[model samples]
Target: MSDDHASSSDTTAATPAPRSLDDALALMRDLRARCEWDRVQTHASLRPYLIEEAHEVDDAIAQGDDAVLRDELGDLFLQVLFHSVVAEERGAFGMQDVAGALIAKMHARHPHLYGDGVKRSWESMKAAKAKRSTLEDGLPAGLPSLHRAHRLQDRAAGVGFDWPDALGPLAKVREEVEEVASLIDPATGAVTNQDALEAELGDLLFAVVNLCRKTGVHGALALDRTNAKFVRRYATMERLAQADGKTLSTLTLDEQDHYWDAVKAEERAG
Candidate 1:
């Protein structure tokens, strides 16, 4: 072989193909060193990807396909690897430190398994570690509003500040809806004080979320399922309309209702 060919072969042989987590870490370190886009990234710059990948994993899980779930999980892992590599570059810590910290936290939380102390609730254990002005003070403001509300309710429930049953939140939901309705003109359905409507709607949603929590359902996941259902049904309606040489917008409200009912019946029958 020519000298260039021999040198290229040696370079290729030096960097083995990744087969495990250690290899993934080495690969990430190499990308940070050599790839232009990867090299320029910091934890701050990649923050959005971290959140986006997590949501993608959520989507994949909702879809309930193992293949898609595995791919999305890997995408989420990439975000973890990216942050770990970035921190390593800054001498803050590396993947080892991240894994070690997690293991330590697990051992502390599950002392029954690891030996020494009894099992403790994760949230209560977390609260014990912090000194906060209020329960909400420790929560990140950037959490999705629905998730934030859910977490806030969870924290309150941790301190015995919860309704005894779903009925309480169900009643609160009705009250919030009534408060919201009071802001609207009954005759024309014109909403007065749009800001008040928005606030009342928020209250209504919070009450609904609380009800969902009391019912042992995650509000976010439940909403996600409902959103997906709506999209599917609407798409089916649109398809049915197209089959009749019309679009949903071209149909009268009653005609649209017919299509919606048909879709619902079809779904039920299926």
Candidate 2:
């Protein structure tokens, strides 16, 4: 063979072809049939792992690492394949069924792209599919409180039951805060009515979420940023304390506060 042709043949031999979807499905089927561990896993058993993989994908996105995001996405895709294989073994459904349903739903939802119909809001389309009797119906009870609050507000707004503007939500926030404050005894600085306190605090959070919605800020993302900021500042405080020959835990509250202020000032100056 010519030298260039020989080099091309060697490169092809060294690099394996990318696996296809069919290859992935076949691998999952084989694992389910032959691997003792894979054979025993159920949907319920894998719930925690699915949640973890999803969070890892989110973390990868936040880090802006394309390689990590690709790997994390692959892990998530495998979970879907594993569940599909399990269902296939039981003769319930398979990956084909899942893909078919997803395609059908997408086509139905995006009429502007797939059909000769006027475009409608996704929320309206989903509401029709939900056939919910109440505004709050179909919301998962397991959703995080802030997310649930946001969804609840969205549902209410869909039916014209929302504040007209940002000012309304801002005012509502102040009202809820006052309600919460009324439940506490100023002298003792303790909540006088625990149940009322809880309810008022929930109202306050819900009002804040409404304000966030009006301002086009996502409550979860905002909280995540704040949490990251706190972590960074606290870590810096710890490092500063250590540099001064004392651990954070060994220092007095005032000393720790001093370091916290220094960290904040340094961050601000930067």
Candidate 3:
């Protein structure tokens, strides 16, 4: 009599190693068919994962490690597969449609590359076909503030509404800073009108973001670098305090400053 237990061949049949894009899509399909979590996921339900995976890919890219970046990119591609499968289940579209649409758009965007034509600006071609009545027509509200500001400014610049150079944005940044300063109470050194202060602060930050764009600097990336630098220096300060038989919490401002200054001096010397 034949045994009912699963053998190595049976296990191999159940779990397959994907060898290509088609194999990956088939693997995703199999997961949806068998896994309860994957089976129940809808496009709307998977939206957050889509956003999170994109950010993880960004972080991996910033880390400058090819292996990690490749892994993150694969995770991001899984989101694409997930959405495509969900769409296919609903009879909306399939992965082939998704890939076909991308290829069509790329070909249309670069007629010179795919057809017999002169090189033309893809944005201008898109604008001709796109019925965008406002500058923020295509910009999503959920975009990061700094990136949104940069995109909005770029759109305005395309229509001849922007300043010619960095000097104009620099001047606007100074003006916005002064307005924010005026909102603060000089005596108490605190803002009394919270609403007005917030509005002024928004203006100041928007101006600064615009200045960053004008100067060819990425505001979010610049802030990310500063955040990392601060964390590194703060950790070094804590370590220095610990070595001196003190906890960071027990150290006074002067004591903390001694360690902070030492860290900075060492960094400069190194």
Cα lDDT tens digits for candidate 1, 1-270: 122211111112133344899887887788778777778877787777777778777877787876667666766787789888888888999899999999998888787889666876667766667665788986777888888999999877866789999999999999999999999999999998999999999999999999999999989989888998999999999999999999899889999999999999999999
lDDT of each: 0.82, 0.82, 0.81
**Clash counts for the predictions, in order:** 0, 0, 0
TM value for model 1: 0.84
Can you write out model 3's per-residue Cα lDDT over 1-270, one digit (the tens) per residue? Answer: 011110001112133344799988997888789877788888887777777778878887888976667666777888899889889999999999999999999999889999778776665666677869876888887999888888887766665667789999899999998898898888989887899999999998888888888899988888889999999999999888888889998888998898999999989999
What RMSD does each model have against the real structure? Answer: 6.9, 8.2, 6.7
Clashing pairs in 3: none
Cand. 1 Cα-lDDT: 0.82
lDDT, residue 203, candidate 1: 95
> Which scores better on TM-score, 2 or 3?
2
Off by over 4 Å in 1: 1-18, 115-119
For candidate 2, lDDT tens digit of each residue in 36-105? Answer: 7777888887777677778878888888877677667777787899889888888999999999999999
TM-score of each: 0.84, 0.83, 0.81
The most accurate candidate by TM-score is 1
When 1 and 3 are scored with lDDT, the better candidate is: 1
lDDT of 3 at 85: 88
